[model samples]
Target: MRKLRVAMIIPDNRDERRQYDRPEPEFGPAPAALLQGLQELPEIELHVLATTRRPMAAPAQLGERVHYHLLPAGRFAGLSGLYLPAVRALRQRIQALQPDVVHGQGTERYCALGAVFSRRPNLVTVHGNMRAIARLHRALPFTYLWVGARLESLAVRRAGGVVCLTRHTLREVQGLARRTWLLPNAVDPEFFRVKREPSQKPWLVCPANIVALKNHLRLIEALAPVAEKYGLTLVFAGGGDARDPYYQQFKARVAQHPWCRHEGFWHRRQLLEGLARATLVVLPSLEDNCPMALLEAMAAGVPVAAARVGGIPDVIEAEVTGVLFDPRDPADIRRHLQEMLERPDWREQMAAAARQRAAQYHTPQAVAAGHVAIYRELLQIPS
Candidate 1:
C-alpha cells in the first residue's frame, strides 16, 4: 500500500536554533508530540512546513519518513490578518510538494491562512479560540487578537474540515467550519515515563504563561490563605511579558508573598522535573481549550486542580481524575486546593486515575492513530 502523504503547517519558535546556535528546528510541545507519534507509524509520510522570521538551517529529513521544510515569512505577516505574502509563498511550495492533505496547526497565525489558500484537501486544528479570546479581552481595533479573530473565522470557514480539541471548541466552530472533528491534543510519551518525586515542602505547580487570561493574580489571591496555612509553596513556571500591566501586578503579588515563586520560562525537561516534584498541578486560567499544561500534568502522574471553565471540565472529571473549581470564585479555588492538600490519599488516587486516563486517551500513538483515521476518512480511503 502507498503511504499517505501529509503536509503539516506549524509554527517553529527557532528557540533551539538561536539559543544553542544549532540548525535543528523546534515546535511547541503538542505538535512535537504529534509528530513523534506519527513518525512511528509506517503507513504515513509526514512533511513538516514551518515559517520563521529569520533564515534558519534545518535538516531536510527529521526521521525515516518525515521531511522538514523551513520557509521564510514576513515578521508581521498576519498582524493585520492579511497574510498575503505568507499565503502566496506557502501555496507555491505546497503546490510543488502536492501532498494528499495539508494540515494547519493553528488559526491564530499564518499557518491556517497558508493551508486554506494552498488549495489542497486541508484541515485546520483550532488550538485556541481567537474570537472568544478577543471578545474576552475586548481587544481594540488593529490589535493582534482583533486581527487574529477575523482570520480565524475566515480560515475555519474556508478549510475543508476543522479539528476541535474539545467539545467546547466544537461548539464554537461547528457553525463556521464545513465539518468538525473532536480530537484531543497529544502528550509527549516522556511525560508518562517520568517518575514522580513529590517535594517535601507541599508544592503546587502552575505551568502556564503569566497572562491576564491565565488569571495568575486571582489565583495567587485565592490560594494565599491555603499556602500560609499548609506551609505550601506555589510555583509559577512559565514566561510573561514585563511590559504587560497584568504581569506587573502578578510580579508585585508574587513578591508580597514569600511562599509564591515565579520561576519564569522553563524548557520541557525542567518542566517535567518540576512536575516530578509537584504535589499537585494547578491551572487557574479564566478560559482554555484543552490546555497542554493540564494534559502534561496528567501524563506525569500528578493530580490536577483547574478552573472549571471552557474545555477543562472535559479534560478533568470532578473528584475522579482531578478537581475542578470556579475560576471566578476565589473561595471555590481555595476550597478545592485546601481539600487536595489535606487529603493525601485522595490526591494519590486522583493522580493514579489521571495517569491512566492520559495513557489511554492522550498518548502520542493513540492521538496519531486518530489523526490518521481522520485523514483516511477525508480522503475516502477504505479502513
Candidate 2:
C-alpha cells in the first residue's frame, strides 16, 4: 500500500529566526503532542506549515518523517486577520506536497484559511471560538476577533471536515461544517512524568496567559481574602512580552497583592515544575475549551479548581475529577479554592481521579489514534 501524505498547518509562535539573541524552544503543547503522536505511525508522512512575520530558509525536516515550512507574512499581518501573502504561499506549498489530507491546527488563525484556499481534502481543528472569545474580551480590541470569526466561518464552511477540540466549540460550529468530530487536546508526556513533592507552604498556580478572558484580575481579588486567612502563595504564569499593555495592567494589579507572584512567562518545562509543587491548579477563564493548563494539571496529579465554562465541564467531573465553579462569580472561585485547601482527603481523592482520567483520555497515543481514525475515514481508506 502507498504511504499517506499529510500536511498539518500549525501556528508559528516560535519564530527563533527573527530573534537577535539565541532563541528558546517553544514547542507549544498542542502541536508538539499531536506531531509526536502522528509521527509514531509508520504509514504516514507528515509536513508542518506555519506563517511567520519574516522569511527564512525553511521546509526544514525536523525528524525522520515530519517536515516544517515557515511561510512569510505580508505587511498587514496583525491588522489584516488573514495574511494573503502567506495564504498564497501556503497554497503553493500544499500543491507541491500534494498531500492526501491537509490538516489545519486551529480556526483562530490563518492556517485554516490557508487549508481552505488549497482546495484540497482539508480538515480543520477548532481550537477556539472566536465569536465567543470576542464577546468575553470586549474590554480589549475586538477587531481581530471580528475578522477571525468571518474567516473561521468561511474555512469551516469550505473544509471537508472539522475537528472540534471540545463540545463547546462543536455547538458553535454545528451547522457550519459538513462533517465534525469531537477530539480533546493532548498534553505533553512531560506533564505526566514530572516528579512532584508537596510544598511545605500551601501553594496555588494559575498557568494561563494574562488575557482579559482568563479573568486574572478577578482571580487575584477572589484569592486575596483566602490568601490572607490561609497564608497561601499564588503564582501567575504565562503571557506575552511584559511590555504588552494588557499585561502591564495585569502586572500592576498582581503587584498590589503581597501573596500573588506574577512569574511572567514560563515555558513547558518551567510550567511542569510549577505544577509539581502546586497544591492545586486554578483557572478562572470567562470562557475556555479544554485549556492545556487544566489538562497538564490533571495529568500531573494535581486537582483543578476551574470555572465551569466552555469544554472545561467535559474534562472536570465537578467534585469527581476536580472542583468546578462559576467563572463569573469571584465568590464561587474563592469557595472552591477554600474547599480544596481545607479538605485534604477530598483533594487527594479528586487528584487521584484526575490522574486516572488523564491517563485514559489525554494521553498522546490515544489522541493520535483518534485523529488517525478521522483521517482514514475522510480518505475512505481501510483501517
Candidate 3:
C-alpha cells in the first residue's frame, strides 16, 4: 500500500535555535508531542513546514519518514494579518510536495493562512480561541490578538475542516468552520516517564507564558496568603519579556513575596524535573484551550489545580483527577489551594487518577492515531 503523505504547517521556536545553537528545529510541546506520535505510524509520511526570518542549517529529514521544510518569511507580516506573501510562499512549496493533506497546527498566525491558501485538502487546528482572547484582553486595533482573531475567522471559514482542542473551542468555531472535530492535545512521552520526587517543602508550579491573558499577577495575589499559611512556595516557569508591563509587574510582585520565585522559561527537561518535584501544578489563565502544561502535569503524576474556565473543565474533573477554581476571584483560588494543600491523601488520589486519565487519552500514540483517522476521513481512505 502507498503511504499517506501529510504536510504539517507549524511554528518553530527560533529562540530555541539561537539559545541552543543547534541545527535542529524546535516546536512547542503540543506539536512536538503530536509529531512524536505521528512518527510511530508507519502508514504516514510526514513533511513539516515552518517559516523562519533568518536561515538556519536544518536537516531535510528528521527521521525515517519525517521531512522538514523551512521557508523564509517577514517577521511582521503575519503579526499585522498581512500574511499574503508568507501564504503565497507556503502555497508554492506545498503544491510542489502535493501531500494527501495539509494540517495547519494553529490559527494564531501564518500556519493557518498557509494551510488554507495551500488549495489542498487542508484543515487547521485551533489551539487558542483568538476571538475570545482579544475580547478578554480588550485588544487594540491592528494588535497581534486583534489581527489574529480576524485572521482566524477567515482561515476557519476557508479550510476544509477545523480541529478543536476541546468542546469549548468547538463552540467558539462551529459557526465559522465548515466542519469541526474535538481533538485534545498530546503530552510528550517523556512526561509520562518522569520520576516523581516531591520536594520536602510544598510548592506549586505554573508553566505558562507570562502575559495578561495568563493572569500571572492575579495568580500571585490569589496564592500569596494561602502559600504563607501553608509554608508553601510558588514557582513560576515560563517565558516573558523584561520590558512588558505585565511581565515587569509579575517580577516586581515575585520579589516582594519571598515564597514566590519566577524561574522564567524553562526548557522541556527542566520543566519535567520541576513537575516531578512540585506538590501541584497550577494554571490561572483567563482563558485557555486545553493547555499543554496541565496535560503534562497529569502525565507526570502531578496533581493539577487550575481555573475552571474554557476547556479546563473538559480536562479536569472537579475533585477527581484535579481541582478547579475561578480565575476571576482571588477568594476562590485561595480556597481551592488551601483545601488541596491540607489534604495529602486526596491530592495523591487525584494524581493517581490523573495519571491514569493521561495514559488513556492524551498520550502521543493515542492522539496520533486520532489525527490519522481524521486525515483518512478527509481523504476518503478506508480506515
The Cα local distance difference test for each model comes to: 0.89, 0.82, 0.88
Off by over 4 Å in 1: 15-22, 76-81
TM-score of each: 0.97, 0.94, 0.96
With a 3 Å backbone cut-off (N, CA, C), the pairs that clash in candidate 2 are: none
Q: Count of backbone clashes for each model?
A: 0, 0, 1
Q: How do the residues 191-308 of candidate 1 rate in per-residue lDDT, one tens digit apiece? A: 9998988998799899999999999888888987767779999999989889999899989999999999999988988998999999999999988998999999999999899999
Candidate 2 error regions (>4 Å) = 16-25, 56-59, 77-81, 138-142, 240-246
lDDT of 3 by residue, 79-183 (tens): 543777678778989999999999999987788989999989999999988998998889998887898899999999999999999999999987789888888
Across residues 281-358, which tens digit of lDDT does each residue of candidate 2 receive?
Answer: 899988888788889899999978899998889989989999989877888888888988999899989998998999
Candidate whose lDDT is highest: 1
Arranged by TM-score with the best first, the candidates are 1, 3, 2
- Clashes by residue pair, model 3: 238-265
